[model samples]
Target: MKLKFLGKRISGILAILPERELHFDDEIGNFNFSSSNSLKLKKIMGYGRHRLADDDTCISDLCIFGLKYLFDAHLLDKAEIDALVVVTQTPDYLIPPTSNIIQGKLGLKHDLLCLDINQGCAGYLVGLIEAFLLLGNEAFNKIVLLNADVLSRKVSKQDRNSYPLIGDAASITIIERDSVERGIFANLQTDGSRGEALSIPAGGMRMPASDSTAVLELDGDNLRSKNHLKMDGGAVFNFMQTEVPPMIEDLLNYAKAGKDDVDYFLFHQPNKFMLQKLTNKIGVSPEKLPSNIVENFGNASSVTIPLNITFNLGQKLKDQSYAVCLAGFGSGLTWSSMFLRMGELDFCKIVEFVNKGD
Candidate 1:
């Protein structure tokens, strides 16, 4: 799908990360592989340390904490939020939408709109698209887009494929209508046939979580239960190499712009190696695409894009405007990209989620 939005912009962004940090070396013994092979994997994948929320923390907790920080700082006003949009695969509960939970907890206005979208890696772009669409209504002005995930609890610690690099994070992006009449162009594609490449086999209504579903079993070289995150790394990598470059080309062509025209490519940080390969395939400079999120903060699903911006270009983006391309691909077999003029934020920063007691 091709999309174009005018007179909408992101005014600010905030990423909230857990205070607890875990190093790759510390978790080597948790994997079945030898120390030598584990070290090799770390070196190749750029594994360092990642933040994980504590056992009791949920996505709502992270969002609420971040929102409170903004509110307390006077960067955001409660009455000004026209809508609350949360994009996550790890909602606090299956029945009650997490957006509503956040709104209720924060005592936000009853007239505000609350929506929850079940999406992963490409969630930031998805959330932004929805936010921009919401601003089309003349009555709406400011929208809060929260992209988060707490998948550390869903993945098996014994599973080397995902555990060491799993991080939990939430990003709050403030979007509002702009009078400047700027254009935001984007494209999205999905292949449901390939959805199983990255999914948790059991959890939803089709297969409820049971004792049998929670039994850890050998999945090739790793151990994980049906409730754990299952990833066909090779399939996903191949999909990215094959599908993303063309998508970027199509989007650029549709927008009548070339790759060089984009000042930065803020993409999802699955890991360093995969991002490097995609950058090469897309014919862009490595410096333009940042891949350090996984090493420093892990892959926070849809939150990676916003986290990347706040981590890598926070200070620069606060006052400067740039033509940027944002892309995310994974989980749901979805790939989406957007090109827009962004920056001059009211604020951009990351805050540690301090525990209530600590």
Candidate 2:
């Protein structure tokens, strides 16, 4: 899908991360990799450490915490929010959407618009698009777009290929129709035939959880079951390289912008090595590209994009302006890229989680 929307601006972004963190060294007992090999993987995969929620925590907990912080900080008011949209694969429940739950928890007006979208990785771009469309409605002035995922709970600790790379995070982005005429130029692509490249195959209505799905067995040197997250690393890497570069080039052309015009290229940090390769292919300088979110935060799914904003551009966003090109690719075999100018944020920061959610 190729599209564009005008009059949408990002007022602020707040990303919340769990307090409990896991380091690569801690995975020795969970995986079969040798010490030397584990160190090599850590450097190549950009696995410095990743924050994870406690066993009882859910994606909503982090999101609600961040949203409340934003509200309390006076960066935004819950009363002014006319719409709430949450994009997550791991909702609090299988029935009532997390967005609906959030609306009730926040005590927003009952007439508010609440929607939950199930997407991964590309969800940030998808949410931005949704926000812009909702802003078109005069009745809906302020919109909160939330993107989060707790994929750590979906993977087996024994699966080194997927476990160490997954992290948990949530972000609250306030979007409103701005006076500036600047808009978003975006292109989205997907290939469901390759959905198995990254997926959790069970626990959905299509394949309800059963004893067979719960049976953990050897997958190469690692162990996983239908319920655990799975990824064909090689296939996902190939997909990224094959589909991403051209998409970026086309997006730049669509917006009539050059590499030099973009101040920062904030992309989904799948890993450092892959992003370095993609940056080289795109001919964008390393200074203009930040690919190290996975180094400290791991891959927090769609939350990775906003996580990048708060981590890398937090200070810049406070007093400067920037034109950014954001991209996300992975689960759902989905890929998306957007060209937009954003800065002068009312708020931009991250908060560490505590026991409040419990």
Candidate 3:
């Protein structure tokens, strides 16, 4: 199942930071409450409606803005896009799905195929696989895959443990069928038995919204006491150590490549510590790995992978095979990894104009 990497194109790309920044507190009422016994600040990141210039706008609005920018960049002259796939867990609405909203806002033709995948961090890789499968049929020529999530919206502000780590952002990628050789070698896996390693417990069919369902208490800092993100940090670390490296090895073997063949390793941007551990365990040198945006952008869920490719990788390496191993393990305890060969594009031109402030 070889697909030519016929030059992929990206359109709209935008990121915004919220006004309020939340930091981690170690002391609770003159007593050390933090596990580390030290107070450190984590950025509580989000983009409000004020930033969008419309109070009625939600996080999805920022996504819309990014999507429009991509369409314009592609220079499509009023052409109707064939398909729209939105990979997001924190969608704008629960019932109608965010893809439908995006489709309407973009004024895509009625015949457009629109859907949403609720695969959390692994969503982008899985979504890309779906898009590739659909586009590979030779029937559809162009497809738009959008990965956007405002994770800060769901984060519990009062949960000092999680409040400082989550951030929000959106990204859009336009995929088309071409004869170039830079798509994907699908290698995906999951373990539902250990699913709750990381997750948001409320606000789903399993536990729908209700008054008696206990309103999440908000502390003085505007952080929620009850609705915060929960994770067994140690358990997750253990799982990562055991699962990620071998998967990478297997994927490389399946793709007919090796650790030394990859131009750079772009795994899920979990955090600095986790990334370091994974890299060391996998025997990948620091220079060969992409920069982790956790410090500034935090975990953008599905957008992390694309953001790395767009902002970090850019056009630095050309004609090099990039082994992009996307491992998303959290919430449902689901994880998936896929290797893709990224060909060189004229990123210098794109960056020159963007940097020149044009």
Candidate 4:
């Protein structure tokens, strides 16, 4: 799908990362690989420390904490918010949407719209798209788009493929009308035929969680249960390399933009290797496309895009505007990209999630 939106711009961004940092070396022995092989994987995949929410922390916790920070800073006014949109693969519950949970916890107005979108990897782009759409309604003025995931809690600690790179994070983005009337161009594609390329096989309705699903069995070279995140690494890599560059080309063409017109390509961070390869195929310089998020903070699912911005370009974004391209691809076999003028925000920073009373 191709989408175009006008008169909508993001005013602020706040990314909250878990305080708990687990280093790759500390957990190297947990993987089923020789030390030399594990070290090789780390060097190749850009494995470093990843943030994982403590057992007690939930998706709602991060969102509430980040939202309150904005509220307290006066960067955002609760009363001015017309909608709350949360995009996450990990919800606090199967019922009572996390958006509603956040609104109620903060005691926001009843007239506001609260919606939850189930998406992954491409979530930041997905969330922005949904936020833009919601702004089309005359009733909505300000929308808070929250992209969060605590998928470390979903993956098996014994699984070498995903454990070292899984991270937890939440981003609070404030989007509202732009007086300048700039156009935001975007495109989204999904291939459910290859959905299993990245999925958790036994958590939802089709196959409810059970003892059988929880049994650890050998999956390739790793031991993982059906309840854990399952990824066909090779398949996903091939899919991204084959699909993303063309999708980005189409998006740039649709927006009548040349590659040089973009100041930065803020893409989802799956790993350092994949991003560099994608950047090569896209014919952009490595400096224009950052791939260090995995090495610094691991891949926090959809939050990676916002996390990338806040972590790498927060200072610049706070005072200057830039023409940027954003892309996120993963789970759902989904790939999405957006071209927009973003920056000059009220706030753009990352805060560590500190527990209350700690």
**Top candidate, metric lDDT:** 4
Off by over 4 Å in 1: none
lDDT of each: 0.92, 0.89, 0.60, 0.93
Model 2, span 1-358: residue lDDT tens: 8888887899998899999888878777678778788888888878788888898888778888888788787888888989899999899999899998888887888878999988899999989888888888899899999998888899899998877778899999999988878868999998999999998899999999899999998988999999988889899999999999999999999999998999999999888889999999999899888887887888999999999999999978979879999999988888999999889999888999775645
lDDT leaderboard ranking: 4, 1, 2, 3
Give me the runs in candidate 3 sitting further than 4 Å from their true place: 1-36, 39-57, 75-80, 181-183, 211-226, 315-325, 345-358
What's the CA error at residue 182 for candidate 3, in Å?
Answer: 6.0
Tens digits of per-residue lDDT, candidate 1, 1-358, equal 9999998999999999999999998999999999999899897887899999999999999999999999999999999999999999999998799999999999999999999999999889889999999998987999999999999999999999889878899999999988899889999888999999999999998999999999999987799999999999999999998998998999899889998899999999888889889989898888888888999999989989999999999989988988999999999999999999989999988999988942
lDDT of 4: 0.93
Model 2 C-alpha lDDT versus the unseen true structure: 0.89
What are the candidates' C-alpha RMSDs?
A: 1.0, 1.1, 6.0, 1.0
Better structure of 1 and 2 per lDDT: 1
Q: lDDT by residue for model 4 over 7-80, one digit each (tens)?
A: 99999999999998999999988888898999988988999989989988988999999998988988989999
- Report the candidate with higher TM-score, 2 versus 3: 2
Clashing pairs in 2: none
lDDT for 82 in candidate 4 is: 95
Q: Evaluate model 3: give its lDDT.
A: 0.60
lDDT at residue 222 of model 4 (Cα atoms) = 93
